[model samples]
Target: MKVLPIFLLLFYMALDGLHAKELPSNGNDEVIFPITELQIYADERGFVNFSDVLNGEVEFVISEDFQPKDYSVDSYYWIRFPLHLNNIESKQWLIEFYDQTIDVIEAYIPTLDGSYKKITMGDHYPFYQKSFDHKNFEIQIDPKLHGEIVYYFRVKSHTYADIRIAVRSINRFIEYSLFEYFLYGLFYGMIFIIILYNLLMFIAIREVKYLYYTFYIFSVGLYATCVDGIAYQYLWPNSPQWNQIAHGVFLFSLIFWAMVFGHRFLNVKNSAPRLHKAIWAVIFARVLLFIYAIVFDNSLFEYRNIEILPLSLIFYTGVYVLVRGYRPARFFVMAYGLLFLGFLIKALLNISVIPFSIVSYYSLHICFLMEMLFLSYALSDRVRILKSNRDRAMQRIILQHKENVKLKDKVNRELERLVDKRTTEIQEKNIMLEEANQKLNQQTAEISKINSILDLDNWKLKNNIKEILQDRLINKNLTLEEFNKIFPDEVSCFRFLDRLKWENGYSCSKCANTKYNDGQQKYSRRCTRCGYDESVTSNTVFHKIKFPIEKAFYILYLTNNRQNKYTLDELSEMLSLRRNTVWNFKKKIEQAFSDKEDSHLIITDLFSYHINKKVS
Candidate 1:
């Protein structure tokens, strides 16, 4: 029975050795397992264990594709490669995985004791727990392999991971990593310098376009680091899960700021108006996509090719504006053009359309560098063109000033010549005017005596007419037109009240102060001692009347006149006031007269002067 088990083991080893490749002896030797050399199997149920794989229960299929891939995120991919490692005596060897973004990796190596040893490593764990302090996944093979052995690596990720395993001697791995990090330094250094320069430009120029460009390039750098695992190793060494989502975060920022910067720099709102509205729509859509990726499904972040849409739109906007005769858009077009090509090459690589290489892998970084330089040049070129236009305008103004100065000099000379001729003509006219002036002076003395006599007669005539008009205001038979002749408006009525109420002297209504300054009103007085203001109508029967002062003055004049025969309706029609308004005012005046204690004095005249004796 033991012989039967040894015979079965030998038979299985013979079958596996047929597919095994020889492990190199030199530590400098490097080898890559292509799709033809490796066998792939997906654990769709994720329940297949190492015992099933070792017992030859699971079937593995060889892929004809250029690179092996974990196509579905819902399953685990088990990749097995048979290697003749019986000759690993000369130097050390390690398995290196190129894709650092894989969430989990389990390497199962066959031991000389005829059992499989398992090792688990991935970005899901902290960086401090990593076997090798490097960006890529590396597993060191022990020198205990007896004969041909099959190595199995179970790859699982939330996103599609490119499965490329390179078997390198320690010497080659060291050389390759040093050169890669060196190139990364140069790449990031240039980006840093460009970002710093653009940031300074934004600060100095105070333009929003420069600010947007600065943030766009910064996002590019951060995303590149996240893609290659440099950020996991150095940025957040403790948090490996962040390595998964950093790319999506930075890429969202990258395209977002790029669209914004392009909009302003291209002057797209004015240049391509219809397309201008479309850019914002695309931005809105991109934002919605990013939100969905974060909140619901982070796997959507792996759809990096979606960025091509916005970048293409930006490129088209640059072209459209440039074709419309916008000269500053030249560098802008070149910048986005290279960027679009980089994304194109990357998208092609994702599908195995382009061969994977160091140059091909970092193509986006190179294009980002080129695009950064061109965009800075674009901003500077715009400023240069604007300065040229301003300089030309200044030159035109200077030339116009010179022309105006010559025209003004010519006008001054013509005016001087005209003035000389006019001066001589006026001198001759002065002599004739002086001789005529003597005769006019004698005639003026005779006219002056007659003018003085006429002015004195005119002054007396105006006074006699004014006295008669004022005197007729006391007549009861006067009509509305006749009453207006003495008090035509509120000003005339207030003036009469001012003169009649303060006929003897001025007095404050509240404090009865004899001294006062000018009040706020025209015919009102303010007391100097108590500061009380006595208006022209304050103490009179006309105070606070609802109708106009002249109308109230007319009503009072008619009421005081004993001969007045006009009824309330007739007075209302003549004064154009309501009957009740006219009647109410008449009663108010009568009440003032009835309130006076002096029965001997005329009612209207005595009532006004009763309290303060102001109208006496």
Candidate 2:
């Protein structure tokens, strides 16, 4: 049995020595493996001792897929590989885990004496706790292995288990770090410029929408930095704990501000109330995720699960609003479409739905650059449109002003012609009025002579005759005998009054009917249409007079003849009536004539003649 064991050990040693001569390398500067060739064992309970892996007690399975793909599991993973250094002259080599977000990593390298050299490095621990002082999880392999030496890695994470390992020479890693940082700096510099420009726009325009976009851009830039591992190397090198959670925090912030930007830019609340509510729902989910990140120390695993929900909802609602005919959404849709494509590519890669490549790794930043430039163009386009509208409005106002000026000039010309025509008419009327005044003076002189030749009673009777002539007795100077001939009785006097009142034919006061019947009273009439009784004097000054019609007409004639020219006592003495009775009769006639001067030509001309006579 001892000879068999010794022969087996010698056979294994010779086979391992032959395998060591074919150590993978390309020109010896660095060896870039397409995939990590390792035997992996998953410890589902997460409590498997490292001794079990070293003692060969645990069963190991070879990984078929070496490409970086997400593995969501609660188990700890053990990865074993062999480092053959016999073919390479230099023994100094660096083993680096490319992914920055992995929580805990433990490396176990076999020593010549069959013991293991262990090193712990991951984002979960402080920078001082790492095996190497580098941004990524790096470990410098011991330079003493002469044959095929086995290496082990125990990996665990609260986030995605997406591991990509690389082994490079020290000088090559330094060159790679410088070049990678340069590219990262260039990317961030572009983002910073966009942020600064938009911030200035926000200040200049004082629009909350621009401010929201600025914050969105800033959060996206920072999140991209975190995702690319630049933030861990430079921004927070010492705080590995912060570096671990930075991705989740910045991602949540990016989505939060993106929703805010959409809300203001789209005016969704006013334009689409239902869609606005959906946006709020997405925002609420983002808030809950943000709270989960802050409150739960190890919430990164949960955050990664629903990381795309907020942006997906925002994109969906944005397209809906655009389809609803919001004009401002035109450019927004184009710009966000590119951004969403970038996000889709990255998210697909993150979930292992797509393979990793240069396109998948840097496509988001490229799309970010495109989005920023496009959005800037969109803003400039909006400004151009606003300026065009303002200029058009100004042109319309100027045109309106010119039209008003032309209209005013035309009105002025017409007014000048009208003024000239009116002036000529006034001059002709003045000449006619002067000639009429001379004739009136001559008539007054004749009337004075006639008055002087007559006695006081005849003069008074003549004045009463003048009043009657000036009334319905047009153009006729009549004596008392002639008046008696025309209005010989009370029935004739009342009939004359009725004819004067209804010269246009009788009409009902209420119904406005033309036909009427003879009423009971002498001056009364009844509407045939409505059977309503109406007296000629019903709405006149003699409406309820107890005096006889002839006497009432006489009294009115005396009152009209006297007017303001004589006192009530003088008129009463002339008419042989009481002072109170004459005064009351005078008031009734004056009241009847009030406001009727335009329609009643008899009273209007009589009053005008009296006024002219007094003025002359």
Candidate with maximal TM-score: 1
Residues 449-563, model 2: lDDT tens digits:
8778787878677677566545534343333355455456778666666666887777799999998888987768888889999977787777777656655665565445433
Per-residue C-alpha lDDT of model 1 across residues 1-616, encoded as one tens digit per residue: 0112455556667888888877765444888876555788988889997767766888998877535242778888888877777553667788888888888998886665555667888889888766799998998877666577668889888776878888888888899899999989998998899889989988998988888888888998998899878999999999876677889999999999999999999999988999899999999999998998999988788889999999999999999999999999999999999999999999988876778787888898888889888888898999999999999999999999999999999999998998999999999999999999999999899999999999999988766665554454434356777556656788867776776778899866677779989989978888999988778888678888878988887787778877788999999999899999998899988888787755214434432332122211
TM-score of 2: 0.64
User: In model 2, what are the clashing residue pairs, if there are any?
Assistant: none
